[model samples]
Target: MPLADAKQSDAPAKRERAHAGAVRVVAPARLHLGFLDLNGDLRRMFGSIGLAVDVPRTELVLKRSQTFKGEGPDHARALATLRKLADAYKLPAGYEVKVTSAIPAHAGLGSGTQMALAAGAALMTLEGIDHIPSRLGEMVNRGARSAIGMAAFEQGGFIVDGGRGELDRAPPILVRADFPPAWRALLVMDASTAGVHGEDETNAFAALPPLPADAAAHICRLVLMQLAPGLMEEDIAAFGDALTEIQKIVGNHFAGAQGGSPWTSPGVGRVVGALRAAGGVGIGQSSWGPTGFAFAPSQEIARRLYDSAIEVARREGLEILIAEGRNRGASVEKIANT
Candidate 1:
């Protein structure tokens, strides 16, 4: 359907004009640093920390319609997300949604949650409705397990979330800060492999033993005492060291579910080790597996790490990407209908 002409008036017209056409949103991809606790005394579980990155973002273009129509490589998932929002909010069934740029799915890059939030935000914008991240996340059934993705989508940077207990709301953000601009993250991915997900993911969690009390306490200490302070002081080496330690702890905790190795893919450990040997620091896997990341304090060092690891990654059929930390969140815009 053709977009309704914006009414001519003063205040109301200005508001209408702002949302009279199509709504477009670009949501960032996030790297899951590690979970703080799986077993907690307060009934909370899986508190998490992560950082958003500018590349591999999910981009969507949406407009009101007489019937729901979805287009693009990720159209199926986008349509499902839109339907959930529509049903929950009693919104119209009609919408034309298009996924322009797609994030890599199931690579531990927060693709699913970002896409869902992007679609929901676009629909809300098309309707000229204002919303906070948690509400938008709820409308799309995201932030159920971890709030890091939702918070990153709302406002990029490093985010730490309190664990989810009995609360139906999105996990509260305990900390949020802009990651240092001089540091870069080197992402290594095995495109041929998929991480644990869906029913498999559910079963994996169920079969795993609870996190040990001691490990949880240690992780908390690293995050609070080392990682947080390092960021505050802009000390890359300190932050990187703490992050590496946290990754090792978390990786070992989940090793039972991810085979005998701490990393999901066999080559990940080798790649990480090589990066570290070449001066990269703060190395770890993102989420379930197959995507690994390391930090460098400067672009030159990042490039050096990538160059050194590319040969090893190629031997394992993996691809490497260099991304800087994103200090700002997603962007949404209204495009005038021609």
Candidate 2:
């Protein structure tokens, strides 16, 4: 807890925006992309699309630590999410927290809902409290079933949400946009497999089997007529062909929990099919597998699909790069409390 910099003037404090005390937060590593109404018929379900990237981030910080702790890169899942929001908002759990950098945990990159909404938004600005990021992601369970990581921690762009509506909360932001900043993605990681999260992702959605209401109504008319008019007409081939036909219909219904193969890592699914055969066009796999993505339309076509998938992503261990879309969110500062 020693990070002082309101403007120390060396240009190192913008952990994505916001700076002042021992309360950092950062965030940004979304990209769920797919799941527009997982067939709840009309009662609502898991409508998504997400984006908010800018390369694997999470940050975290907090101050005053005599002991209630956590330390870096998944600090024990950020001290079990700061001991469940410090015992559900009783606050002050003797701060020490420091997840210096995260987002890799389960590989689908929502790293446990962005480390439980960046440890409940840095303990609500170190206990000033005043909730709202879905009520501090409901005291730390961080949006149970996609609100696009609590609206990408409060407003990064290109979202969509509007799903779980029977009153469980979390799914709401029906649209956000602005992701066409010269569009570019790539991603592709695979840090040695890790995606069917906790309790096997609730028993792979209770052993999946329902999605048919006319194929969830034709993937909701390809996200309202071809992915929101190819993201407001930037038109990366009509938004990569409506996000590769909604990731081939939600990766063939989660490909029998990914063993049937929507790719949990068949070498990052052959480097996302050589980054969509080197043209990279909104490929798939992001929220339940060895991280994959593609979508390129600038930055020189994502550096020619990262130099044509950098040697088949290093002969298939995988690691492609090039990200972009993070239209602002997550950044809560307040340093100098050492």
Candidate 3:
């Protein structure tokens, strides 16, 4: 898809393109800061914080169609649910949805959820449904519940989902704050190695030991006293320390269920250790398993960390990806006449 300005004037002599029904929706990728300790049956209900990143994304284009089948069966199911929701209130049907995303599959970026939501919103538009955006979250989650979907559909800063609740509850209230501009997150991932599957992933959560109150209290304090304030003040050092501490604590708690250790990715401990040795701070895993992220105050620091990690990987013959945090929102691609 090519980027274009809707504001551009169309040649008066050219025919104006038209479609029976069409809409486009862009959904951003997300990063989990830490796992929220949700109460039993609610699973991670304590409410974890998540932020959108620009690198990986999901885009959906919807138009009227008589038949549906192909590559994304999950997306198809999501569209069907949206169509049913539209019909419950007397709305149009038959939609063609094309989904595209940059977020890596099985990397814990919520790619499927984002695609589902983008498709859902576009389907609603194609069907001429005029419902509140608040309802979109729950509706989308019915098909994919990665919370990142709910968070991206809503916007700004950090977001948390309160679990199965009324649509009126909407997306959990977002706590807005700018991540320090100097901070760069180097995401080290392994594409060849697969992590836990979705259902097994859910089971992993189910198997987690109830978070001890002491640990939860400690995390709550760090969020309140250090993390939130540090970001607000743009205090990189303080923010890094708090984040690093929180990650260590949470990582330990999660280890019980994942066997051996609850690491974001393999060899993450080495990367975190190397980054720390190189004067980088704020390091941890995102969610579930197999992707590690660490913070550097500047490109200089990041390079140093990357160089060291590279040497280590070479010695062991491993592959890793290094990505930075995007201050802006998700990238959008508008399909032609979409």
- Please identify model 3 stretches exceeding 4 Å from their true place: 1-22, 36-44, 69-93, 131-134, 142-149, 160-171, 311-338
Tens-place lDDT per residue, model 2, 1-338, is 01121113222212322433478788998988888878786888878888898788888787756678776777787777666655544443366887778888888778777777777677656655445677666555666778887788788888888878888667778788878888888888978778888887999988898788888788878988988888888888888888888888899899888889887888887878877876788798887878888888788879977887789788776788788899988888777765
What RMSD does each model have against the real structure? Answer: 5.0, 17.6, 7.5
For residue 91, model 1's alpha carbon misses the true position, in angstroms, by 3.2
How do these models rank on TM-score, best leading? 1, 3, 2
Colliding residue pairs in candidate 1: 156-329
* Alpha carbon lDDT at 307, candidate 2: 89
**Candidate 3: TM-score?**
0.76
Best-performing candidate as measured by TM-score: 1
Q: Highest lDDT: which candidate?
A: 1
lDDT of each: 0.83, 0.77, 0.59
lDDT of 3 by residue, 1-338 (tens): 00132112222202222333466666666677775454334343545666665555666566656655323424664566555444443332355666653466667666656665566566545443443334655544432333544655556354545433434344354365555566666766666555565688789767877777777777767877887888778787887898888888888877775566757455765766666777777777777646677777776777777887877755544444544444454333334454
TM-score of 2: 0.34
TM-score against native, each model: 0.92, 0.34, 0.76
Write model 1 residue lDDT over 110-167, tens digit each, in one string: 9888998888788767766556777677656677778999889888999999988886
Candidates sorted by lDDT, descending order? 1, 2, 3
Q: Which stretches of candidate 2 lie over 4 Å from their true place?
A: 1-30, 38-41, 49-84, 87-93, 102-112, 117-137, 144-162, 169-185, 188-216, 220-243, 247-292, 295-305, 309-338
